[model samples]
Target chain A: MRQIKLKERPDGMPSAKTFQYENVDVPSRNRDEVLLKTLYLSVDPYMRGRMSTGPSYAAPFKVGEPLNGGIVAQVMESETEELKEGDIVTGALPWQEYIVADPNQLRRPEVHGAPVSSALGVLGMPGLTAYFGMYHIGEPKEGETVVVSAAAGAVGSIAGQLAKKRGARVVGIVGSQSKGDYIVNKLGFDEAVNYKEENVSEALKTKCPDGIDVYFENVGGEISDAVWPLLNTFARVPLCGAIAAYNLSAGESDIGLRVQMPFIKSRVKMQGFIVGDFSEHFREAYEVLSPLVKNGELHFEETIHEGFDKVPDAFLGLFSGENVGKQLVKVVEPEQ
Target chain B: MRQIKLKERPDGMPSAKTFQYENVDVPSRNRDEVLLKTLYLSVDPYMRGRMSTGPSYAAPFKVGEPLNGGIVAQVMESETEELKEGDIVTGALPWQEYIVADPNQLRRPEVHGAPVSSALGVLGMPGLTAYFGMYHIGEPKEGETVVVSAAAGAVGSIAGQLAKKRGARVVGIVGSQSKGDYIVNKLGFDEAVNYKEENVSEALKTKCPDGIDVYFENVGGEISDAVWPLLNTFARVPLCGAIAAYNLSAGESDIGLRVQMPFIKSRVKMQGFIVGDFSEHFREAYEVLSPLVKNGELHFEETIHEGFDKVPDAFLGLFSGENVGKQLVKVVEPEQ
Candidate 1:
């Protein structure tokens, strides 16, 4: 079996050397455990926080331990009555070729007429994050402007489309022209700004003439600064991630927001969250989002890495703004 | 009659030069207007946002116009049936000795044993801000550690005392030793840290050994940098003010929180709010807060400025971190 481990913590930006790939013997399943081969691994921006030894909402990965992620795997062997061979499941598995999971931790795929990889993106955590972040926290009203950063990324693309279906005026902020165009023309955003080219604040001023009412914040940093001035009274900001400032080394200071005072003065609500924190809302989110996906009213994009060996490279690309849509690694062949 | 107008737009921190104290004839009351003799003026931190030309939750004060604030006044003449001569009321009135007001715009105080000045601090907006900002946003659970910045100030003090009343561990962060001692020894905060003297992070680490579950933010900037590292998972931050950053002049470079990305990883909920947004919760807040105050379960202190002429000087002191508790401007003589 092949696994990826945290070799050393990166100072600023992570590189290939930050992760160590190892070949290991696959462990046998105990009494109630099922041995499985990982078919796909989810590569998300949130993993950056796990690399640091700071006080994170989640625990940091110890150096030399195999990096863990949400993985879709097929059961190769079962040691209990509940599971059988060739059954596909999803669970928190490592960045490895195979994993042994308790059946209680395994969730059978819920998607119909869609690739299993959907279980990692729109049908899974990323999709639910967008759903709960917007609906529960954002409470977006009809005809209100909803702004989203990382517009073409896994979570954002879904968030924008969901906002659109709810009759909100959706504006997307992306890093590239292609991503911007995709969100506007293909994904149904009212307008999209390429932050790499145009000034985000200026574009936002033009697009959201009345001001942004809901901000689904996936990328924090300069983009956050731009969005602050445009927030209207009672604006809701659902802070999903801050991929922009993840890798600051010693000597490099953290970029702080000068707009914090304005947040209080403007009565804006900025809430930071993780998908795990909103699990209770999953069933409701699925009830709403599942139909949108089936009716083609909601669409998602994926930047797929070919195999398990490419997981580290895929994750490292997140900080550099390389991947488009939800990033994932195909770890094994699908069963017939 | 006297009125205070904006002489000029402030360059950075507001000074006396920005205000013009002029003697103008008091306008006559219309058929529906009541003549008011100003007795007290409420000066608040949010007024700083109005001083700027930048967009705020409320419209910025126009240059060359009279500065408006919440004021307590006695009805000198009444043209409306609802208000009579000698009746005391409070509402948004300009900074002046006498003025004409529409009776519909005033709310009569239900002042029983409490002083009318309490309406300006502990029983009014600042008090409401602390009440709702804590209950609605912070959502402090029993036994949770609550950390509040600007602990000696109006809203912060009330927030700290409220947290303690709710059975949570409260730690206050202040700028001076005296203010720290007053809060811990007198007002009953479990602990207090003078952010200016000691290493804040170390102090917070020691005081909040279990980690900060709720952070009532009043002073942002460097103080927030230290507090960010000590927050616990599912922590709630009610960001009520960022008084530290209000003095930045034009063309000042951005000072972003470089390490704030952990908010996402830790799943911390940081929300900013203005008091009026939760108007529906005001009665509910008063229902809970009033009994605490009447029973002396909630302790409060006020830093009263001697006269209305001292309003500009009192406001300037706020930027310098000079106040010990709630800051108020006395528009008339205290009861003999």
Candidate 2:
């Protein structure tokens, strides 16, 4: 079996050298345990926070330890009646080719005619994150305008689509023209602002002539500065992530225009949240998202890299806007 | 009669030169109107926002126009049945000794054995500001910790008392030792941090051994920076005012540590609001607050400057932290 471990904590932006590949023997399963072969692994931008020693929602990943994340696996041999051999399950597991896990630690995702890998994207954490943030915090009303940053990424793509479902005038902010087009044309966003090519503030003013009522903040810093002034009275901002500040070097301050004055003037409600904050109601989110996926009312995209060796590169590509939507690594093929 | 007009918009901080006091004729009342004698007027931090041309909750004060704010007045003569001569009322009125207004613009405050001036402080807009911000937004749970900045000011004083009423351990951050003693010894706060004398962050950590669950933010800047790291999971911040950044000169940015990362990690909900946001439910707030004030369960203080000419100086004193509790100007005594 092959695995990847954190070689050393990166000072800022992580490189390929940050991860060390290792070879290990597959361990035998005990009673109530299942021997599993990894199929797909998720590489999310939030994992960057876990890689460093910092104050974050999740505990920091220990150096020299095997890196772990959301993984979809197939049960090769099961000792418990709860999960049988050949059953597909998803769990937070080590980033390795073959591993053993208790059946209780994994869940069988409802495919609903979609690929099993969809569990790592639309039917999983990213989808649930979008569901809670947009539906609960953003609360985009009908006829209101919504602007989403990083609109082509995993969470933002789904978040924008959810806003569209709520009958909001959805405008997406993306890094590239292609991502902008994907969100607007394929994902049905009302407008798209390519931050790379256009002045985000001016472009947003022209696109969102009514002024933004809800801002779905993902990539903070300059993008956030552009959105703040355009916010309408009583605007809601769901602060999901600040990937732009994730790689700031030690002692580097992520300073920008202060939000206090503008926020008070606009009576803005800005709330920072993670998907797990609404864990108790995840079933409600899944009920809402799963139906949209099955009926094709909601659209999603995935940028999958072949082989387990590509995990580090796939994760690194998130910073450079290389992926269109969910970034994943395919470890092995699930047997029919 | 006398009135004060905004002579010119101040470049940064306003001085005596910014106000132009003029002798004017007392306007006569028309049909459905009442002749008002100004008894008391409020000088609030938010009025500073209206002094200059900028994006704010209220429109900027015109250079040649009289500034208006919450004022308690006596009805010298009434042309309608709704009010009569010698009746006391309060309204948002211009900075003048005597004025004419329609009866609909004023509301009779229920004094409940308290002074009529209470209408402009603990029983009026400032009280309502604290009520909605602390009660609805902060929602301090019993046994939880609540921290209030500008703790001796009108809104903060009331807000801290409200949290104490809810059974939460309350801590107040004030600018001076006297103000700190006032919040702790007089207002029943569990602890007080004098930011001018001690390190605010360190003092807060020692006082609030339990992390802060609710923060009533009345001052923004370094005071806010100190509270951010001490926030507990699911902390709620009701941002009522940001006086620290109110006087930033044109083209000067009010920059500070970005709140996105810490907020997300702690799942903080920071909401900016004004009393007007809860206008529909003012009766509900009054019903709850009036009883507390009447029963003497809620204590209040006032720093009343005598004479209408002292209004500008009283307003300026707020920035310098010269006055404790609600700062007001006594324009005249009621003719009993």
Candidate 3:
């Protein structure tokens, strides 16, 4: 089986030279283990953070080890009673086409008649991250305007929808004009700012006339500067991810502290959270989100790349805003 | 009577040129008011924010208008039964030798057997600010290492003592060696870092070996850069003031955005708050803090600028780090 491994850490934006594709031996499954055959794997922007050696919520990807990510797989063989042959599961699986995994660590995702890839996108970690970050941290109230950056990405798309359901006027900041239209028309955002073409601050002032009450900060460059000064008093900012600055070298720094005055003046409460921060509430999140996603009350989009070797390219594409929504690599077709 | 007026808006550091001293006739009191003679007028770092025409927690002081701030005054003539002659009160009184104010708008501070000037320092706004910001926002737990910047100042001094009282190890960052010595030797801080002498981040790494669990962010700029990276996962930061950035022109921007990565990687919760945000809880803060001051469990310092005419000088001195603890202009002699 072919697997992707880290060849060298990139200084700035990562390139194809940073990854190595190699054939690996398939490991044998022991007691309480299941041999998983990779089907669909998730490609997220946050994975870029794991490539560097720094203080991160998730451990860094080691130089000679196969890259690990969210993967939906079918159980080829089971040595434990918890999972059996042909059972489907998802978790932090390796990039290889096949591997042995503990049944305890794998999740039995509820597909609910949708594509099995939904197990890695909407009903999985990204969806759950949006649920807790928006509800617990942002706490969007009726008539409040909510602004989210990278609105076309996995977490931001789901977060914008959840904020709308809570009676907030959602405004999204996207990298391209089409993605802006996608979020505003297809995903129900009240307004969308094309960060590429428009004067972001001026656009926010015109769109968010009531002032931004809840800012779901996903991208953290010039987009953040445009959002902060417009925040109303007692505004809440849930710091989800900063795909904009994730690729900057370790020694590089930006002008983020300029917002401290605005933060204090507005009495802002900003928190940076990981999905693992709410680990105990995972089931609670699933119970609420799974139904909305299945019934179409909540909407999601996925951009899929075919074949196993497209994983690294799919991930790198996230930085340039090439993907429309939840970017995933389709490895195999599930059996009927 | 003498009053201080804002002559002009400052570009960087405020100076005597920005303030105009003028003589004004003491105005008559209303039916529900009391004529007040200033005893001790407070000069705080937060006033720096009010001098500029920008978004701030408090309204900006208009050019050619009298400046206003906290003052301990004695009732000279009472037009209401609620206040009588000789009754001492404190509130947001104008920066003048005398004024007329409503009894309801003033605070009849509970002295708890300490000097009446304590009403302007530990028994008043700065004390209450530290109390709520540390307890409610920072949430310093026992055995945790707490760090407070601008340690020898009024708010930071009390905040450090409060953290020590909570059984946490405290590290202080101060401007000079004397202020550094004052906090560690006199105020019981576990360690002190001189931002002027040593490298701040390296100093924090050496002193806060366990990593900072709670950071009372009183000063922004490079000092903030030092404290943020050293924060532990799920750490709390209470944003009090930004004296360092207060002097920077409204148009100037700093490299504050660099902290976002560290903030997210550590799962940090940083909130900016004014003491007035918790107005209903003032009595609760007083009930806990007053006894600590009377019993000498908590110690405080004051830099007294000698006369009512010295008010503007005292206010101006704050940006240069003139005060050791609370900077107060002694407006008049106490009752003999």
Q: DockQ of all candidates, in order? A: 0.06, 0.07, 0.07
What TM-scores do the predictions have? Answer: 0.73, 0.77, 0.76
Model 3, span B243-287: residue lDDT tens? 556676656764563333323333345354433345565445344
| lDDT of each candidate versus the true structure | 0.65, 0.68, 0.66
Best-to-worst ranking by lDDT: 2, 3, 1
Docking class of 3: incorrect
Which regions of candidate 2 are displaced past 4 Å? A257-336, B257-336
Residue pairs in collision within model 2: none
Task: Give the DockQ-based CAPRI class for model 1.
Answer: incorrect
Error of 1 at A271 (Å): 7.3
* lDDT tens per residue, model 2, B75-128: 888869999888888889887878899988998865444556655655555666
Model 1 score (lDDT)? 0.65
